[model samples]
Target: MKRAQHFIGVAVAAAAVIGVTSLVGNDYYLRIIFMMCVYYLCAAGMNVLVGFAGQKSLGQAGLFAAGAYAVALLTTKTEISPWLALIAAAAISGVCGVLIALPSLRVKGPYLAMVTLAFGIVVEKLVGEWTEVFGGAQGIYGIRPITWNDQPLTSQQWVWFAVVLCALAHLLLRNLLQGRFGRALLSLQADEIASASVGVRVYRAKVIAFVVAAVTCGIAGALVAQQNQYINSDFITFHLSIFILLLVLFGGAGSMYGPLIGAVILTAVDAALARWPSAQHFLYGFLLLFALYVMPGGVAGVFRALFKERTETEAGEKSEEPPKTTRIGPAGEGELLAVEGVTKAYGGVKPAQNVSFRLQRGHIHALIGPNGAGKSTMINMLTGVVKPTSGSIRFLGQEIAGKPAHLICSMGMGRTFQNLRLFSDLSVLDNVMLGRHTRMRNGFFSSLMGLPVAGRQEAVTRGRALELLELVGLAHLAHQPAGSLPYGLQRRAELARALATEPQLLLLDEPAAGLNPHETAELGQQLLRIGRCGVSILMVEHHMDLVMSVSDHVIVLDYGIKIAEGKPAEVQCNPRVIEAYLGVDDEDDIEARETCPPSEGRRDAET
Candidate 1:
C-alpha cells in the first residue's frame, strides 16, 4: 500500500541521517538533533491532548519534572538499572497525568489551564525547595546514563538512540491516531455531548489523552536527564511548558508530522536565541500570539491550504447505490422502553412532570408537542443527557434512569439532536463511523500497535458507515465535510450516523423541522423502512404529516403535561387536544367540534 511505502521511506531517510550524522556531524550539531527528538516526543503526545482531545494543559512541565526527578532519584539513590529507572519514570509521570486529568473532568477552558498552571508551579517549588531529596536549586548530579551492551553511549550514539525513538514514536502515534482511538479523541474535541451520545466514554478518553501526553513527555525528560547526567528545577519551568506547546502550534497541531516540524523549527530557534534570554522570551510570546491568531493551523495547515489535499473518492464508483435493507436491530416482540413517573424540575420550573410512556419493539412512536412543551426534555431524559428528578426508565427490562449517556448508548440506544450536533469538520463517513464506537471490540493497545484486529475492525466499520450513508442518500457526499452539506442533507447524515449505532431504539428530535415537503416525505419513507428493519423509533417532530404517515402511535403534550395519546385519527378528535391547540371557548369548541371532522382538526392544528 502507498501508506506502507511512505512509512518505509521515512524510516530509510531517518536511518541515513543517523548514519551520516554519526560519521560527519560534530557534537554540537548532534546535540541539536537530540533536543529536537526530545521536543518531538513531547509534542507528539501533546497534540493528542490539545489538538485532538481539545484539552489545553499548561502543566506539562510538571509532568516533565516528574520523569526527570524520578530517573535522577532512582539512579542516584538506588542500584537500579538506568533503563529500568527510565520505565519507572514514565510510570510515575503517567500517574501524575491521571491526577492532572481529574481537574479536567470537573472544569474546562481557562479554569483547566489555571489548574494545570498551578500544578506546574507547585512542582517547581517542590523541586527547588526540597533540598535533601531534589538537591534544591543546585540540582541532582552523577545520575547514571542509559547504556548499550553494558557500555555508556557516545554523544553521537545518544543522538542515534533519540532518532530511533522518535521514529518509533511517529509510527506508533500514526497507528493510534488513524484508527478508532484517534477518531474518538477527535470526536471529543468536536463535541463531548455528541461524542457521549455516540457511545464515547468522554471522561475516560480525556484521562487516556492526558496519560499519553504525560508518558511521552516523561520519557523525553528522562532522556534529557540521563544524557546530561544532571537535572534541576531549571529544567522544569513555566517557559519550558510554553515552549513545548509552541512546538505543536508552530508546526501543526493535528497532523502527525506537525510535531516533528515544530520540534525541528522551534528547537533551532531556541538554540539561536540562547545568547539573548530576554529577547527569546519576548519573541516566544510574540510567536505564541502569532501562532494563535494569525496561523492557527501552523506550517502544516499552510501547506494544506496551498496544495489542497486530493479528495478522498472511491474510484470507478460514480453512481450511488440504493440503501441496503438488511435487518438493523435484533428481531423482538416485546416492550422496548418504559418510562414511569418521570419528572424533571429546576426549582419550580418543571419541564416534565410525572410522565409515563411505553414504546413497543419495532414500532415507530411519535411525540408531538408545540414549542415550550416537554418533548425535547423527555428525549434528553430517555437518552441520559438529563437525569430525571424521580422516575424509573426501563429499557430491555433493566432500569436505566440517571445512568451516563455513553452507557445508555452502549445499551443499544441511539439519538440525533434537535439542533444538529454532527462532527461537522469530519468527513460524513467518519461522522457515521463514530456511531459504531461502542460496537468496536479492539482495545487501546491493539489500536496503538496497529494490530491486524484493529485494521479489520476499522475496515468493517467504514464499510458499514458507507452503507448507512447510502441508505440516507448521502453516499455521494460521504467523503465531504459533514458541515458543508445542505441542512436537509445534514439531517439525513445525522440519521445515517445514528443508524450506524445499530440501535434497538432510535430517538430522533425534530428530524423534519427544516426540510421541504419532498425531503420530509423521503424522511417519512426512511422512518417506515427503518421500522420494518426491526428498529423501534421514538420521534419528536412538529411536522404532523410525517408523524401521521410514519408513526404507529402518537403522544401529545401541552404545557409539560400529556394531553392526548392514541392513533392519529383518535388523537386528532380528542377534545383536550383540540382545546390545547385552538384555545376555543366552550360553546365555540362544542359547535366547531360538531361540524369539523377529525381530518379537518388535524389539518387545522398543523396550520
Candidate 2:
C-alpha cells in the first residue's frame, strides 16, 4: 500500500510539473516555479541537518550566500565557466559548513543556534565590507546568463531543468533518509547516549548532516543566482535564513515533501500579497499565525493525519501477542566484561572509586546501590559516555576504557539509560531500525542509488527490528509514535532498540524503575530470559525484589565503595550491608534483641 501511494504521488507530481510548465509560459509563473525549486533544495538540505540529524543550524543563508558569491565571482570576474563555478560554489560552501559545524558541535540547544546565527552575520558583514571582491552594498551586476552550447536558454527551459534537478535531489534525499546513514542520524537525534552505545559515531553523523545540508544549499544558491542574473549579498541575508527555517517548520521538518509544500505555499502567498502593498505584511503575518496554530506539524503532518485515518479507525482489530523477552542459552565459560579498579570523580566528588567487577558469559549481574552510590557513573564509564579517572575496562579481552561511546558499542557492548530516551517524534519501528546502523555496511552512494546490497541489508535490518520489538512486546506499536506510548511500554521499546544492535553484552540501567509490581515481576523474567540467549547482562536497578530474583550475582555499593558481594540472600544478611541501610547499632540490636517491654512496665509508665 505504501509503495503504491509513493508511485501515485510521484506520478501526480510529474504530471503537475509538466502540465503547469506547458500551460503557464508567462514570466511571472515561471519565476515562481524557479523560486519554489530553489527553496525546495535549500529546505531539503536544512531538513537533513535539523530534521534527520537533529542539529539546529540558523546559518543556512550564510552558506547559500557563500555559494552564490563564489559562483558569481568565479564566472564573471575569473572567466570560469558557469558550470564549473557552480561546482566550485558547492565545494566551497561544503568546506565552510564543515568548519562551522566543527565549532558548533561543541555546543548544543540555544548555544549552537546562537553560534550559527553569528556565523551568518559574520558572512553578511564580510560580503558587505569587502568592496573589491564582493561589490560591497551595490553587489555584483551584469552576471552572464547560463546557456546550452551557444544558444541562451529561455526562462521556461530553466524552470524545467530546475524542476528535474530538484526532483532528482528530492528522490535521492528520500532514499538517503531510508538508508543506514539516515538511521544513524535519527538514532543520534533520538538518543545520543543510546546511539553511541549501539556503535553510532555521534560527532561524525552530525558533521555529515551539516555538510550535506550545506552542499544542497550551495546548489540552490547557484541556481538562484542564475535565475536572477544579478547576484548580491542581500540575496542571502539573515532574513532569508529565518525564512528557510520557517519553511522547514511550517512544512513539517522530517517529511520529505515538507520543504517543497512549505516553499510553494509561503512563496505563492508572499508573492500574491506583494501586490496589495499596504496590507501585505499584515496578511502574511496573519496567515503564518493561522498556520502555526492550526497546523503545528505543518502541511506534511496534515497529510499524514489524513492517510492514517483508516488505520486509526481499525486499530482495535490488530492482533495480540505475548511480550517477547531476551533469552540466551548457556555458553562455554568466557568473560564478557571485566572492569578493573574503575574510578570516576566529578570535581571533588567521587562517584565511582576503585569499582572492580567481572561479568561472565550468559550471566545476569546486578549492580545495586542507593541513590548517588555511583552505580550509574560506573555504567557511564563502561559505555564511554564518561571517562574513568583511573582503571581499565576490557570487553572480550580488548581494553576499551577510554574509547568513545560509539566505538565501545561497535565492539559489542550495548547499554540503556536510567531515563527513557526513545526518539519521541520517530515511529517505534524507526527507533529500532536505528539500532541496526552499526551492522549496516552500505555507504551514502549505495543508499541514494538503492543498490541491491543496500536494499537487502535494509530489509534484513527492518525484519530484525520488528523481531526485537516483538521480543520487547512493542510489535503492536511499531507504527505508533514512540513518544505516545505509555511509560512502561516506552521503557520496553528502549530495550528493544538496544537489542537491535545485536550486542554481545547488554547494559540495562534501571530497566525496572517505573514499572508496577506485576510489571517488575515480568521484567525480572525477561532479564533471565535474556541471559539464556547468550547475551551477558549487567543491570543497574533499584528494585530490590526484581534484582534479587533475577540476578545471578549481586554486587552492592555504598557511597562509591563496594561493601558486599555474594548471592542475593547472602548479601542481604551482610553486616556491612545492614550497617549501610539500618546503622551498626541497629544491626547489633536486631541480632541481640527479640521482644519489647513487658505489660507491667507499660502499666507503670501509664500511671
Candidate 3:
C-alpha cells in the first residue's frame, strides 16, 4: 500500500511538472527544464558509484562523450534510427564504465580518482585533436534528433520527454537501491572485508555500480547531442565532470531525491552564473568546498535531520522474551573442516606453523592461547582473510586453501572478526540480511524492476534475519542501527549476522571479547545451542570459563605452534598445557623457590 502511494505521488508530481511546462511555453524555461532532467539522469547514476558503492569517479565525462559521439556518428553517417543509436551509445558507455572500474580493484581513494581523471583527459584530447573521425574543433554536425510519428519534437515536447525519462530512471533506480542490490552496494561502502565475509562479491558490485553511472550519464549525453543536433569536444570537459559530481554531492549523494534536488537547484545556479563565465568556476569551487566541509550530507541530509524518522528505543524495556533457537545447517556426514599443515608466514614471522585440525559436525571446538598465540591468525587463514603459506584446508571435503573470502563464505563457512566488523550504519536486521545475500535467488534485473519475486525473497530474508536475531537474544533491537547498540549487544548482533549465512562450520574469533561475565555466560550457552542445531563451531577465545564450560573439545596453541588437543577436562589437566601457560624453572633459576600454585597459573592463563 505504501509503495502504491509512493508511485502515485511521483506520477502526480510528474504530471504537474509537464502541465506547468506546457502552460508556460517559454523557450528559456523549457530549456532549463530539459537540462534539469538531463543532469538529473547523470547525477542519478553517479550516486550509485560515489554514494552507495563508495567509489569516487572523475571520468564520467569520458563516458558521456562516448554516448554523445556514438549518437552523433550513428545518426549523421548511418541509416539507423535515432532511438536505436541511443541504446547503442548506452551500451558502449557501459563497457567504458567496466574499463574504468578495473583500476578500483587495485587502487582506491585519490589514486583511483587520478586514474579516472586521466581517462577523461585522454578522451578529451582525442576528441579535440583527432580531426578525421571526431571532426576536431569543428565538432560533429547534422546529428538527428529524436522524433515522434516521424516528426521532430518541439521544445515543449522535448521537455516532456526528458521529464518522463528522468521519472523512469528515478523509479527504476529506487527499486534497485531499496533491496538486496542496494544493500550489497552499501555494504561495500561500509567495509569490503565484512561485506565479502557475508558473501558479497566486492569487485563485481563495484563494476555494476560503475556501469549504472555510465549508462545514465551516457544517455544524458546522447539526449543533449540529439536535441541540439550538434556535438563538440567542448561539450565534454573536466568542468563538466566536476559539475556532474557537484550535482550528486551537493544534492545528497546517497539519498533517493538527491539527484533531482541537485539537478534543479545547481542547474538554476549555473544559469544564474552564465552571464559571467569568469566567476562561474570560482563560485563552483567555493560551493564544492562548502559542501565538503559543511553540508557534507547535502540538502537531502539536512532535510532528513529536520524530519528524522521516529524509532522505538529499548530504554524502558525491562526484558526480552526467551530466545527461540533456530535449526542451523543440514546434518553433516562426517568432517566439516580439515586443516593439514596449514601455515602462514610473513618474512621471519610465522603466525601459524604446521598446524592441523579436523572439526566434526555438531560439536563445539575451542582454540585458546595467550596473547600472540596465532589463534586469530588461524581463523583468518580458514576464512581466506590471509592466504596460507602452505598446506590444505578442506571444508565439506572440498579443497578451499586459496579461495576468495566471499567464495569461502558461500562454500558453507561463516565467521566473525576478532574485532567487531559490523556494517554499523545499517539496521541490525539489514546487517544480518546481508549474510543471506549468497542464498538469495533473485538477480539484478529482477531486483531492479521491483519484481514480485524479489519482494517476496526480500521479505523472507528479513523474516529469517529477525529469527536469527531472536536466537541470539536481540530481536527487540532488530530495527536499531547496529553501531548504536551497546558493545555487548553489538557482539550478539555480529553473531546473528554470521549465523544468517547458515554455515556448516562457523568460525568465531573472540566472540566474547569485552563482554561482562553474564553476557559471556549467555554467549557460551548460545554456542552450545547452535552446536546442538547441527552446525559445527570453531571458536577462538581468551575467556577461559566460557571455553571450558561450553566447548566439547579443546586445542591449545603457543608461539605459533599447536601444543595440545583433547577433551576439555583431559587437556586442562595436561602437564604441557600447564607448563605452556606457566613456564617451568631451570637449575639456573632455582632461586624461584616452589613452583607457582596451579590455581594461580590457571588464573594467569585466563587473564
Compared to the true structure, candidate 3 yields what TM-score? 0.96
TM-score of each: 0.97, 0.90, 0.96
lDDT of 2 by residue, 1-607 (tens): 3534765676678668966797886898888888888888889999898878878888998999878888888878888777788889899999989988897557987888888999999998888888898887788886666789866568887887788778778777877887788878887777777677777788888888998889989888887877677787667677778777877878887788889888898888768876785575565456557657887778898998888554352222233766555442336677878888888887889998898888888778888777778888888888899999999899889999989988887778888899887887788898888887888888778888767888889998898888887776667778888887778788888888888777788899999887888778878876776776667888898777776677788888888988888776666666665556556565556564223322232211100
| Colliding pairs, model 1 | none
Residue 199 CA error for candidate 3 (Å)? 0.2
Better of 1 and 2 by lDDT: 1
Clashes of each: 0, 10, 0
The candidates, ranked best first by lDDT, are 3, 1, 2
- Superposed on all Cα atoms, the candidates' RMSDs to the truth, in angstroms, are 2.1, 5.5, 2.4
RMSD of 3: 2.4
Q: By summed lDDT, which 10 consecutive residues of candidate 2 come out lowest?
A: 598-607
Q: Which ranges of candidate 1 are over 4 A from the true structure?
A: 1-3, 310-321, 587-596
